[model samples]
Target chain A: MRRLIVGLCWVVIPWYLLSLFVGSRVLPFPHAVAIRFAELAPSVLLRHAAASVLRVLAALLAASAVAVPLGLAMGRIPAFDRLLAPAAYLLYPVPKIALLPILLLVLGTGDVSRVGLLGLVLVFQLLLAVRDGARAVDAHYLLSLDSLGATRTDHLRYCVWPLVLPRLLTAMRIGGATALAVLFFAETFFTRYGLGYFIMDSWMKLAYLDMYAGIVAMSLVGFVMFVTIDRVEQHVGRWQG
Target chain B: MPGVTDRVIACRDCAAGYAGRDVFTGVTLGVAGAETIAIVGPSGCGKSTLLLTLAGLHRSSRGTVLVDGTPLESGDPRIGLVLQQYGLFPWFTVLRNATLGLAIRAKRSGRRFDAAGAADIARALLEQLGLGGKESDYPRRLSGGEQQRLALCRTLLLEPEVLLLDEPFSALDALTREELQDLLLTVLAERRVAAVLVTHSIDEAVYLGDRVGILAQNPGTAAGEPARLLLEANPAGRRGVGRTDPLHHQACAWMRRRFAEAVRA
Candidate 1:
């Protein structure tokens, strides 16, 4: 908590200094932005923030639900790895943003398209991370469990799952950051419900204060996601500490 | 040491190696219930490989291993192994690591796991092994000796008829090693479980083993020749034999001389 406060001070002081140096409507003071954020949050900012948070979370869950199992299979099953590894390797490097238009066309301009695009962006990272994690289980632990008369199911449950969870959580954390960035781009198109729409709409009206407020809200979403993941990681991988 | 029919675990003419290289060959041994046979050898003499084979975690290329007069099976619940590294899962709590064997047994046998029963059993063993009040602590937080105790506790949970240890206490400091050696003595005597202990420490082998075996390659043999076992009864082998006992010292000295000749002659 102290570190967070100190970090906020570091960022806020420089930001406030920059705003004063600019001294124009384009660069409002941090305090001025803070007041505008407080005023707009209760009415429109909260709703936009909620929509954006929901879309990002839904996308993250959808991607994880699909990718984690696939990645675990790839790591453990040689035949499955041979089948899917080439596809994952080939598709992982492609800029997922380029598919945004296609997704928007197929899924329409609803939240589904935006969520789908963000899910596509995050899945590859998580898939590769989890696969590597599963494949990297140490031989020592495997032998230990084997000598205990553990079945294949017991091996997966006791040995593989616990060892791989921390890696998955770490990948989720990194992926969440990307999800927020891609969420911003996704919200800007054919949608009036997200922070991306509100921020861009505010910018068009030259309401710099409101745009800053939307950006802050979006950052809060990311901050909360990260903190949640850290808490879960702590609970699962406390032994690592 | 005994007739093959009276042994709880017996290995005859067992030879094992990785592809393209032999590790150990022509090994024969038998352990009756509650007996311990300790092995000491030069590095790369395949003492660990021999123990792993006995544990059924490795396959011997020749001969047969019999447990209770039946052919040995991989992952047999009646045999437990304690490794030198104290193979407790870091991601699990001390209690969970101890209970893991029971859970594996339950799942392997198609029986529904009774969590409460397993916890009770695990807690008792942990408490007996001096790991009480540490059920929730992960293995990473425990000291080296504690981690080893947790490993021992886990293996003992299965109540196996035989135990195979590969340098189980070589990592601990002197005082803790002696402490654990005594603890192991008590447990082995109480449980009447047959055991094979592999260690570099000749004193440890003399103190704990009813017999000591040396695995060493022949001095004139080619580099490709695998190490072979030289098993003998220990002069000082008995329960609670003092480390400084004259017989213990004699036994350690005799074994040291034999082991040196076996490894370097």
Candidate 2:
């Protein structure tokens, strides 16, 4: 009950403060910003929010598909770790936004480019988390498993997977947030829909109230997404103890 | 004496070590049914490595380890080992872990678990070990003593013919450690399982072993193999029957000198 009330307050109070009062110039009354928010229309907000969420989720799914396997392989095999670790370090230092021009050039200014760019950024983050988590597993546990006559595959599935999964979920939480942030910047480049495009459009038109409103929308979406994943992690991967 | 009893595990001219240096060379030992041998060694000796080799987890550079009269292979199932680390799978509930050995063996045999039979045995074993009412608990939730007892239960649940204990009680407090040591002696006796227990404590070796084997380390050398069983004294006698007798004390004194000599060798 308390949580529900708090959630309602978070939504209602922020919408009023951003849409009604704060603006490029002080408004005499709350009615003017309210009229402008109404002008943005329900259809436009729904369409743009849907587009943004679909793109981000698609990118995240793609990233998870590729990065998890690659990370697990690198972690299990020492030679692979040695070969790929340096390259991963080198690529991670490069700001993901810097890849925007190349992505746009190759994939064009469509949703494809935005989703692909988001996935690319997420790969480095999730893979690093997987590798570190796998490496952090206790050597004794692996040795015990080996002594039990477990095959390598058995060792991996039974021992390594459980040990690393919680950490992997944590990584996803971080990676998802980063992907969302990068998507905003990436979309600001060339996009017809999404909250990023909406925010830039409002700013260009000098509608400061709409700009703040879009910012609030993006923040709310990111926070909700992160919290939802965190809760799922706790439920699905109950701590061993 | 050798073949009459049917030697379950035989380490023949075995040379074992860590990181390439031999700890002991041409070391021969035979463990028969219901026999309990304690390995007593000074600190930094290769008792742990020897246990690993005996368990068939490590390749002996110079010799062979035979189980059930056949050459033992890597990760041999005939040998069950418990380490001081208490390497219980933290993700598994106590029940799952206790049945892990049976499950693995059943899978290998292409047979499903006799669930009722296995559960009955697991419950009885846990009850004996004082871990009843905690079947659903995971390893991390257990205290150190509980974990050690669970580790014991897990090993015993397999009903392995030969048990290898590598300093299984070193991590516990002194009282708990001694209690566990006694519990282990009782369990091994009850199950009639041949066991090789490694420990740094000479008193423990003397107190529990049918025959205590002493190992010594060379100074300034990590690679020097601990000296072989220069002294094999049965202070505790058969099944620890005469453990507190004067004969036990005299045997301990004799073995103590041999251990000191091996260290200075």
Candidate of highest DockQ: 1
List TM-scores for all candidates, in order.
0.94, 0.86
TM-score of chain A of each: 0.96, 0.81
DockQ of each: 0.80, 0.51
lDDT of each: 0.88, 0.78
Q: What is the lDDT of residue B210 in candidate 2?
A: 78
Encode model 2's per-residue lDDT on B70-185: one tens digit a residue: 88876677788897798888788888788777776676667887877887899899999999999988888888999999888878877788999989888899889878877988
**lDDT per residue as tens, model 2, A1-241:** 5765687677666655764656536332334444555666476655677778899899988888887887888888889999999999999878878888888899998888899989888888888888877777788987787667777776777777887778778888888888888878877866778988888888899877777566656766787787788787876576442
Cα-lDDT of candidate 2: 0.78
Interface RMSD of each: 0.9, 1.6
Model 1 chain A — which ten-residue stretch has the worst lDDT? A23-32
The CA lDDT at A50 in model 1 is 91
Tell me model 1's lDDT, rounded to 2 decimals. Answer: 0.88
